[model samples]
Structures are given as structure tokens and as C-alpha cells.
Target: MTQDNLWQLDAHDIARQTTSGDLRAQDSVGAAIDRMNAVNPDLNAVVVDLSDEAMARAQALDASRDAGTPCGPLHGVPVTIKINVDQKGQATSNGVVALKELIAPDDAPIVRNLQNAGAVVIGRTNTPEFSFRADTDNPLFGRTHNPWGRHISPGGSSGGAGSAVMAGIGALAHGNDIGGSLRFPAAANGAVTVKPGLGRVPAWNPSQSAERGLLAQSMSVQGLITRSARDLHHAMPTMIAPDPRDPFHVPMPWQGRALDGPIKVAFTKNTFGYDLHPEVEAALDTARDALVDAGYKVEDIEPPNVFDCGRDGYRALMGEVYSLMKTDVDAHGSQAIQDIFAVYFQEFPPFLETDLLQIMAKRSHYARQWSLFLEDYPLILTPFLPRPFFKPDRDTEGGEGVHEVLGCAVYSYAMNFLGLPAASVPSRLAHLPQGIQPINIQVVARRWREDMAVDACIAIEDRVGRMCRPLWEHMASS
Candidate 1:
């Protein structure tokens, strides 16, 4: 492997070499910093650069290793944290201008976990205001352009994380998903990510003044977006470490007990009445074929009533946001975000009072249905979106655009409502008239079986191949 291209290496390789003393932490951090400087000005993926701090940490890690401290699993690996998460002394801006000065007094659990595992934080990535959109652009951070091309929207909330990882700024990018934040960027950028199930990873921001809404707490999760699935596998175990801050977090082993036979994958192409774009359908086919080839028992099966689960779930979340967070949003949010939320309320129609509690209770019914179905098939292969990713600002066009970008994403959000681990991995690369884009498929595993979802993503990736090589070629030529 070329030494200069160390920034392009995956977390698994970087950690393996660094742990064996064949690579220095400083070298990995330096290469990542170089990559960030070269590409980030164009993409704006990393809004807060921490190159100097990263190098210092790398040097310290190297000295510790020299002094005979045991190497952690992620030793010397470069990673990026989303700005929404707390990093002590750094503002947990969440892409809001008003919060730009609200520096966190302590690191979030995810940050501490990554540092404890020896992963170097290269920089903080961007997000939409309040980290609440399907696309990334904020008054504070401007926008995150897709590394693939200017025409595409880097999927939001986690868009910066997705873009940074794919652009070789880092091997791993920390991101959170509360209804497709992780999956959206992974799909749009041809990156891979697993939205860990409820409580799979500890999540608590030290800068947060109040606890999140009930649905928000249940639906949202901390995870990573990576160029390849192996990087997720290499880093996620460390992310799941027990933290007293998150009392609800479930302490469990990364790998579950093996099944007795070939893993059954229930596959579906049902787009829930939305027109399934040919590219997306083709991507689902590719995933199905890949899994079958990889020895998974693939069967055609439609996901059970995801439309209802998604619709009611989002409405309930909107209610909570309206009840608890709306004041802050209205007070501090930009006009654009405020308008977007207004439209969101119109489309999703927030449930209120007793209705909110009723919907919250109904969430369990939907989860139970999926749980029973998952028992028959350990995994469900489905479409992440009904169509190819839309252009930037697609959601800003009002109801139609939001419908196009989000309404068709039932598969993506229903998993969140059900609190099941769902992995998104690119299966097809299309040379569209606008630009080259990647289409991703969804793999949902049983509750608390994020490893299973990631395992399936790896199998699909091994067959279809990683997206980074082609993406790099495009970047060099463009």
C-alpha cells in the first residue's frame, strides 16, 4: 500500500498496523489532516478543524504505546465527530448559530468511548439546524457538499460525517441517526452505516440542558458512517461500552450467538405506493443476489405495515418536538429552519395530548409485529429510499419536495420507530445525467442484533465492491 494514501485506508487496516508497531499514530493523523485540508474546503464537511489537537493526541498515544500501555482496538485510527455531539471545550453547535458559543463542559459518552479506544478525532462535522433535516446545511456551518459531486445533497444530520469519510478525511465518521440521519447520508454518499438499535450505544450530551422527548430518546442513536462496512465493525464494539451517563443503555456483547443454519433474509421491493425508481429497484436486486451468493437464505417478503409505523411514529415525534423543543427552535432557529418545521408539522401533523400517548402506546404494537416477523427471518433486505437521492435543498421546496425526500423513506424511518438495527450499504452506482450517484439498500436485523445487520452489509459489500475507488477516480478527474 502507498504510504501517502494512508488517509484512504480503512479503520481495520489502520488499527491493525498501528497496533503491530508498523505504523505511527502521528503518521495516520497527519495523513488524515492532509486529506481534510485538501478536500474539506470544497466539501465543507468538517466545519471545525482540529488538526493540531489531533496531532498532539497522536503523539501522546505513540508515547503511551512506547511506554508499554496496551493498544486499544481503535489505536491510531482517524475519526470525525458530528457537531451535534459534545466534545469538551468545543461548541455543541448542532449547526445552530445561537449555540455557537455554547461550549460543552464535558465530552459526550461517544466521544469518551472513541478516545478511550484510541481513535483520534480529526474534526467536528456539520449538520442541519437542530440536526433535524434530511439534508445538511445550517446557518452556522453553511452546507456540506457531497464528495461525489456538487449536484447531490449530502444526507443530513450525519451528512458531514458521511461526506468526510467518503472523501478520505477520516476512516470513520461519528454520526447519530434519529429517523434516517445515518442511513440518508450513507445512501447519498455510497457510504455504509448501521443505525444501532435503541440503547445500543450510550448517548448523552453534556451541554444539553434538558432530556430529549420520549420518542426522540427511543428513536435516535449514535453510530458511525464509514467508506466501508468493515470500519463500522471495527469501531462499533468500542462505541457500545457501558456508560453511567446513559442509564437506559443496554450492556451486551457485540457478537450474538450464531444461528444453527444459514441466516434467513426476508427481502422486499414494496415501496409503499411510491414509485420505486429503477436504480433503487436494481440496487435492491443486487443486494438480494449478493446475499444469496454469500449463503444467506433470501426470500421475497414485504415488511409489515411500515407505512403506519412510520407515519404515526413521526407524528408522535413531532408532537414531542412541538411540546418540548419548539420553543427553542422558534426562538433560536433561522427563518429557513422554522419554515421547514412548519411544513413538517403540516405534513406529519403532530399528535397532541391524549393522542400523543395513544400513538406512543401504538409504537409497541408495531414493534411487536416486526419482532415476531424478525423471528422467522433474522434479517430483512429492503430499499432505503423509493428513488435515487434528491439534489440539495430538495426538502426546502415545501410539501412535495419533503414528500419526495422523506415521505418515500418509510423503510429508513420505520426501523427507528421499531428500534431495530438497520444497515445501509450501496449496491449500485449509476451514471445519471446529472452526475454519478450511488443507490443503497437497507438491511434490518433483529432487535439488539446490530452485528447481524453489519455482517449482512459486509457480505453485500464483498460482492458489489466498495464505493471509494470509483468515487476517488471521479474526484481526481472532476
Candidate 2:
């Protein structure tokens, strides 16, 4: 293999080579830094470059390796952290300009876990204002462009992470999702990611002044975006390492109990009354075929009421957001974000006060229904979005636009509401009239079965192939 583009290697290969003493930690970090410098000017994916610190850390890791110390699973791997998360001394701005000077005094749990596993933070990626929009742009860091071209929106609020990883700026990009942050970007950028189930991955930001709302705490999750599904498997194990900061975190092992026989998957092309794009339908079929070929017992069935679960769940979340975050957003957010939220309220209509209390109680109802459904099908294959990714600032176009961009994303956020693990992987690359882009399909696993979801992602990936090659080719030609 060519060593000229070491930055393109996945986290698995980087760890294998670095731990085996075949590749120097400094070399990997340097390659990633070089790549970031090359593409980030145009992409703006990495808002805060940490090349100096990353290089120093890489040298120290190399010295430790030379001195015969054992390496961590992610030893020498370069990664990016989302700007919304605390990373000690860096600003957890969450894309709000007014909070730009608010530096974190300590690292978030995900940051500690990544560093403990020897992952070097090359840079911090961008997010939308208050990290709420479906498209990544902020008055603080501007817009993060899709590496594929300007035709696509680099899905937010983890848009920067998705754009950076796929652009080869990092092997893995750390991002958190409340609704569809992780999956949105993965789908937009043609990357792979699994949004960990509630309690599966520890999460806590040391810079926070107060506790998040009950639903916010339950729905949000931290995860990584990568170029391949296998990379998620390699990195997520270390990411789930225990952190005492998050009291609700479940200290469960990454690998769960094996099933007795072929895993059954519930497949559906239901778009919840939205117009399901032909490309998305084809992508779902591709995933079904891939799963079937991989020995999964694929059945054409829909899991519970995803539409009701998604709608009520997001409405409930809007209530929590209105209660807990409305002030910060009103005070610090941009007009663009505020207007988008207006449309969001019109679309989902936040349930307030007592209604919020009742909806929060209803969460268990949705989760329980899905849990029973999973008793027969351990996995569910669905479309991440009813259509391909929308253009930049699409959500700002009012109700119809937000509806097209986010309203149709029932599968993306329903998992967050239910706190179930869902993996997003590209099943087909669509060549549209404007340009070529990848269409991602989602595989949601039973609660705490993130490993199974990732395994399913890998199986589909084995058939459809990784998306990075085509993306890189497009970049080169462009």
C-alpha cells in the first residue's frame, strides 16, 4: 500500500500499524495535520486546529512505544472533537458567538475516553448555533462545506465532524447527537456512524452550569463518524470506557450476548406519509439484499409507530428545549437559528409545562412498544432520510423547507427518543443531475445492542463497499 496518503487510512489500520511498531505515531499525526491543512481552508470543517499540541502528543506516544510501554487500542490515531463538547482549555462554543470566550476547565467524558485510548485530537470541528440545526453553520465558525461539493449540505449539528473525517482530516470525528446530529452528518457526508444507545456511552460536560432536562439527558448521545463501519467497531469500544462523571452511564461491555441463530431484521420503506425518494427506496433495498446475503433473516415489516414516536418525541424534546435552552438561544443564538426554531415549533409544536410532563412520561410507552417489536426482530433497516441531503441553509427556508430537511427524518431521531442504538451506513451512491452523492440507510438494533447494529453495518458495507474511495475520487477531479 502507498504511504504517501497515510491520512486516508482508517482508524483500525492506523492502530494496527502504530501498535505493531510499523508506523510512527508522529507520522500518522503529521499526515493528518498535512491533510487538514490542505482541505480545511475550503471545507472549514475543523474550526480549531490543534496541530502543535497533537504533534507533541504524538512524539510522546512514540517515545513511550519505543520504551516498550503497551499501547492503547487507539494509540496514535488522529481524531476531531466537536466544538459543542468540552475539551479542557478549549471553548465549547456550541457555535454560539456570544459563548466563544467560554473555555472549558476540564475535558468532557468522551474526550477523556478518547485520550485514554491514545487518540490524538487533531482539531475541533464546527456545529450549528446552540448545536440544534440540521445543517451545520454558525455565526462563530461559518458553514462547513461538504467535501463532495457545494451542492450538498454537510449535515449538522455534527456537520464539521462528518465533513472532516470524510475529507481525511481525521480517522475519526467525535460528535454528539440529540436528535439526528450523528446520523444526519453521516448521511450527508457519506460516512459511517452508530449513535450509541442511552447509557451505553458515558457523557458529561464539565463546563455545564446546570443539569440538562430529563429528556435531553436521555436522548443525547456521543459517538464518532468514520469512513467505514468497521472503524466504528474499532473505535467505539474504547469510547464506551467508564467515566464516573456520568452517573447514569451503564457500565456494560461493548460486545453483547450472541443470538442463538440468524439475526432477524425488520425492513421498511415507510416514509411516514412523506414522498420517499426513489434513491432512498433503492438504498433500502440494497441494504435488505446485503443483510440477507450476510445470513440475516430479513423480513418486510415495520417496527412500531415510528411516525408517532418521532413526532411526539421531538415535540417533547422541543418542550424541554423551550424550558431549559430557550433563554440561551434567545440571548446568544443568531437570527438564522431563531427563525429555524420558529419553523421547528410550527412543525412539531412544543408541548409545554404539564403537557411536557405527560409527554416525558409517554417516552416509556414508545420505547416499550419498540422493545416488544424487537423481541422478534433484533434489527430494523430503514431510511435515514426520506430523500437525499438538502442544500445548505435549507432548514432556514421556513416550515416547508424544515419539513423537507428535518420533518421527513423520522428514522434519524426516533432512535434518539427511544434511546436505541442506530447505525448509518451508505448503501448506494446516487448520481444526481447536479452531482454524485451517497445515500445512507439506517440499521437500528435492540437497546444496548450497538455492536449488533455495527455488525449489520459492516455486513452491508462488505457488499456495497466503503464510500471514501468515490468521495476522494470526486474531490481529486473537482
Candidate 3:
């Protein structure tokens, strides 16, 4: 293969070569770093890279292979971490300037597992301030632009991970989803991200005590961002290995069997009270046709009020989180942190304590209603956003602009509120340049059916290919 081809190959392909001694781990690691050095400056996807550590690990893995030691599932492959997650000795800035000096003393559970599986950590990607917004940028890390069009957003919290994967810096990236952070970026940037069912991958933070303890119980999970669905299936078992520190984690094996019938697929081009851009709806149509061509039963279906999940519920969940974060920022008393506080409180002034209590009371109602609805349908395909990738610097605006965020995010947040698994896969390109359409599908199986969600994604991949390679590869030489 050509030198350029080395960097663009997927993680599974790279691992297979390393396992068979056709490619040394160091060569793969070196090519990945070279790709990072070439494209990261423009994308700003990775902010805290561990080049030396990566090379050392790559060398060690190659030595072990030479010595006849067994290789791990993802042995010698490269990956990046979302900056919001902890990595020992690396700062979990989450794109906050106030926390730049705060370094983590230990790795988050997901990071530890990825390392244990023999993956090389190339660097850490950017996130919104505390992962609060849906675009990746802050005073600390600046903005992560889309590899397709430098002026467009890759999508947030996991935006950096999405950008890096599209730019060929790594084969896979570790991403967390709460309010569609992982899938939004994946869809916007024309990659793929899986929001595993809650507790599928253990989660914890040694950096600080948990914020709003209920957030620990609901609406968040970690999984992989990749260019292909098969990669997710390959990595799932290693990712969810039981970690005793995370009590919420269930010990489920990665293995799963596909149902023994033509899969009944349900699709919603838009969501409750949300308007999808015309191009996005067209992309869904294209995706539906692909499934029909694959001999599956495809039907247009409207999901019940499940999309209203966490309206009041999120008020209780996120309102409590906002208050806790306010307390921390106020403790620092820094002008920057204070400024963030002002924007937050101004955006959510009516969040009184009594209102929060009422919202919490409604959580079970929404969760139960959503659970009941999913029993009839196995999959719900929808638009990843009301629109495709929007212009960069657009999301930083709050207030009225926040409405735009909500409208675009209709399909994403509800899954978090219900703690169901969802995956975003690239469907086709929109009319705009580098503007690819991503099929935002929620696989709402019973609790612990993350396997079903991922399996559906693999089926989608078999029918329609993943996103086209980002233009950055060609532009990198410029």
C-alpha cells in the first residue's frame, strides 16, 4: 500500500496487519502522528497530544509481538479521547480556561479500558465549556472546525473526536453522549458515533466529585466514535468490561445475535415540534430506500410523546447540575468563571428550587411512557439534526440562538433522558460542500440491548457506505 494509505486505514485493518507482523505498531503510530501533525492545526480537533507516550507504547507493543506474547483485540491501533474525560497527568479542561492548570491524577474508566485493550492514545480532543454547549470551543482550546468546510461546526462535545476521525488522525475515538454530544458531532462531521446504553462503559471522575448525583444515575453513557459500524462491534466487548469502581455498570457480554426475521424498522424524519431541514429529510428517504433494497420492512412511523422526555425531567436533572456548577465557579471567583455563570443564569432564570422538585417528580412518567412505546418498535430512524453542519462560531451565541440548538437537537436529547442507546451513521452528502447527511437512528431495545442498536448500524453500513473521506486529506498538503 502507498504511504498515504497507511494513515487512512481503519483501526481493525491496522490491528490485523500488526497482529500478522505485516505492519509494526511503531509504523502505524508514527503515521498517525504524522497525520495529526499535518491536519490537527487546521481542525484543532486534538489539543493535548501525548506523542512521546504514544510512540513508547507503540514500541512496547511491537516488542511484545516479536516476543510471541498474545495481542489484545485492538492491539497497536490509534485513538483519541474527548477532552472532557480524564487521562492521568492530562488536564480535563473540557475547553475551560479556569481549569487549564487542573490536571487529572488518574484516567477515567473508559480511557483505562482502551489502554488495556492495547490502543494507542494519540491525543485529547476539544469540547464545549464543561461540555455545556453543542459546539467544541472555549477560551482555552479555541474552535474545532469541520474538516469538510473550515467555517462549519463539527458538532459538540464530541466534535473534536468527530473532526479527528474524519481527518484520519485516529481509527477510533472515545466519546460520551449526554444531550447528543457524541452523535451530533458524528452526524455533522459525517463520521459515526454510538451512545451505548447507560453504564455499558463504566464512568467516574477522580478530578472532582460527581456533579448533581442524579446525573450519575441517568442521561449519559460512553462509547466509540469511528468511521465504520464494524469497528464499534469490534470494540464493544473491551469497552464494557466490568469495572468494580463503577457500581452502575452491568456485566453484559459484548456478544449478541441478530433477530431471526426481517428486521421491522421504524423511521421518523423529524421529531415532536421540531422542523428538519429539507436536505436532512431527503437523506432519511435515501436511507429508507437503502434498507428496503436490503429486504427489510421499512415503515414511516411517528414516535409518541417520548420525544418530550426530560422537558420537565431535564429541568430537574440539568437545573440541579447548573446550580452545582454555579457553586464551583463562584468558589473560584475568577472573572471568566463568573462570566460563564452570568450567561448560564440569564439563560435559565426561572429555574427555582420548587420548579426543579416538580421536574424531578415527572422523570418516571416520561421514562415509563418512553419505555412502553419502544416495546412495539425496535428502531426509530430520524434526522441527526434539523439541519446539517452549520457555520462555525454560530453556536457560541446564547439566548435566541439557543432555540436553534433545541430545534436542531430534537432527536438527540430524548434518548439521553430515557437512557436508551442511539447511533449516528453517515447517510449521504447534502447539496452543500462537505455537508454530509447523517442518519440519526435510535435503537430503543430493552435495557441492555446495546448490542441490537450496534447490530442495526452494521446493517445500515452494509446497505449504505459511511461518509466520504474528508477533503482535509487532500488539502493537508496546502
RMSD of each: 0.8, 0.8, 2.7
lDDT by residue for model 2 over 43-153, one digit each (tens)?
999999899999999999999999999999999999999998999999989998888988999999999999999999999999999889889889888999999999999
lDDT by residue (tens digit), candidate 3, 30-55: 89999999889988999988899999
Predictions in order: lDDT: 0.92, 0.93, 0.74
- Candidate 1, 210-279: lDDT as tens digits: 8888899999999999998988878999999999999999999999989989999998888878888898
Off by over 4 Å in 1: none
TM-scores for all candidates: the values are 0.99, 0.99, 0.92
Best of the two (1, 3) by TM-score: 1
Model 3 quality (TM-score): 0.92
lDDT for model 1: 0.92
lDDT, model 2: 0.93
lDDT of 3 at 256: 57
TM-score of 1: 0.99
Better of 2 and 3 by TM-score: 2
Report how far off residue 272 is in candidate 3 (Å).
3.3
